[model samples]
Target: MPQHRNISCHLYIGDTKAMEYNVHNVDNRSTAHIVSEEGQTFSFKIEAGTALMSAARLDLELWADGYKLDCFTFTESVYEVDDAQVRDQVTGAIKIVKLRFAKLNTVDQGPSNADDAEAEQLKRLGTLEIKLWRSESNVSQSTTFPYADCPLQTPIHEKKIKGQSVSHVTSLESKGTVAQQSSWGYITTKIDPYDRPWVAFVFKHASKALLQSEGIVPKDEVKEKGAAVASAKGKKAQSSRAKVNDTKNEESKVEDVKFDDDVAAMSQPQLRQEIMRLRKRPGDSLDQSVVKARRTMKCVRTPDADNLLSTAEKGDKRK
Candidate 1:
């Protein structure tokens, strides 16, 4: 038997209730249309057979309220069988599937000239539901859909940490004072400890004096110099420590060699005695010593050269 295949996908924005509210606020709802990347229109009707066989492979786009909902990809197969025998056998099989995403409550309602700077505002509030099922005949399949409510609160807000003091600058004088204080604190905390407070005090006084004078602002050059000085001191300390470690390592190596020489000198007599005792043993030790000594020893020059010459001459005459 040849199996029939069908696929269909639909993108839904707002529900009936949300749509009612959106229509009243005409600017919030997006018109129903498939928009391609290049601003092209895509319109196609899904056949029953195609929707049944390949609905699971379709991708859905959902937009509602002010924000665009996340896109959902279907995974359930829907099938419509025309063969009487096959239909009778699989009478209760699901044939249609649909997916709906959460609705966005906010839509841009400001004038076109506002551009991207305008904050998105919510036009209506509602939950979004997605439904998936199969239809046996031409009748629409009834399935319960699951939905999630769209949160109405703004996503971004100015937040202050607990236990922090809030400071506001409303006038030029207040803004200048706040900026000077902030720069002074930044310099004190970020620079070297030795120079931090001194530089901060100098800048703070200079800032105050400038505020009293023609309302001028002091620069942050002192903070920069303090940081540079601290960094140089740290490098110097690190290098000095490294030099000390190198000296210690050299001394340790010298001590190790001296210890080894002392040990060898102390053990020399004992080593020789041990070798002699091994030579007296009844095995190959004595033979090995004779070979070793012969290889190692050299002839010594005698001070009695005349006696050595006379003995050699006599031996020659006798021979």
Candidate 2:
């Protein structure tokens, strides 16, 4: 949360408030979710200082990454903070959406249509921001949003996003009636100088790894979190290994043995040998049965496979 002038704002994820790191006097960056106007994945709260009027009329503007969202204005004197549902003034649409990380591509592999956008647009790919202006209630009327649809994090060239540290961008959690309803339309306000907001909160969000890489997060905390994650992943990997081992140790059942044309004259021991012979191969008995990505197999040449097959065939033929 960041507070400037007389207003305080916070970005909340789940039931916990985000961790804030101060940048300057009032400007701070926080670790938070793709913020929401709709109260599902995350919620945002605004608290107005008592220094303001009884019913303070202010235009609330939201921006994620670098794109401006549908802005809104409300006349509410805060008792603690304004946590109530904010909706589209005319359409009564609840602008609930999800923020997602934009997929990135290499320099040459970038989107072909990206040229259509101004370089300025791609500049704000990793910031979550809010601006508030002191406004007159009746003077401010509802207006259309800059974008036609729900604003999402636009993927850009990897080289272009170099300094941003952000790996994720705001994306819709769900594409549904909310985007259609708001059109990102906001309440246009009458301000003396629209360029200067009464208060602005800018948050630059990035992955924990990126934050640690930038030294934004303390190394000790990073190690603690990393250890926790590694522990969980280790348990999962161990379970997977156990399953693979079980499959490998499983006995070759009688039904699994191949049908032989040598009639039923072959001894039971010879039949067992046939199953054993079929289990090995030239590549150290390949175990590459699962997905390639999981890759739980070894590749090596084993002479024992040839020896076992030869011995089994000879015994079967002698019978």
Among residues 3 or more apart in sequence or in different chains, the pairs in candidate 2 whose N, CA or C atoms overlap within 3 Å are 70-184, 98-171, 98-173, 99-171, 100-171
Error of 2 at 248 (Å): 54
lDDT of each: 0.29, 0.53
lDDT of 1: 0.29
lDDT for position 134 in model 2: 79
Give the top-scoring candidate (TM-score): 2
Candidate 2 C-alpha lDDT tens digits along 112-183: 444436456666766767777777655523455443245433445665555555565555554334445433
Compared with the true structure, what per-residue lDDT tens digits does model 1 show for residues 146-174?
22232233322222112221111101001
Quote each prediction's TM-score.
0.19, 0.52
Identify the candidate with maximal lDDT: 2
Report residue 125 deviation for candidate 2 (angstroms): 1.1
- Cα error of candidate 2 at position 56, Å: 3.0
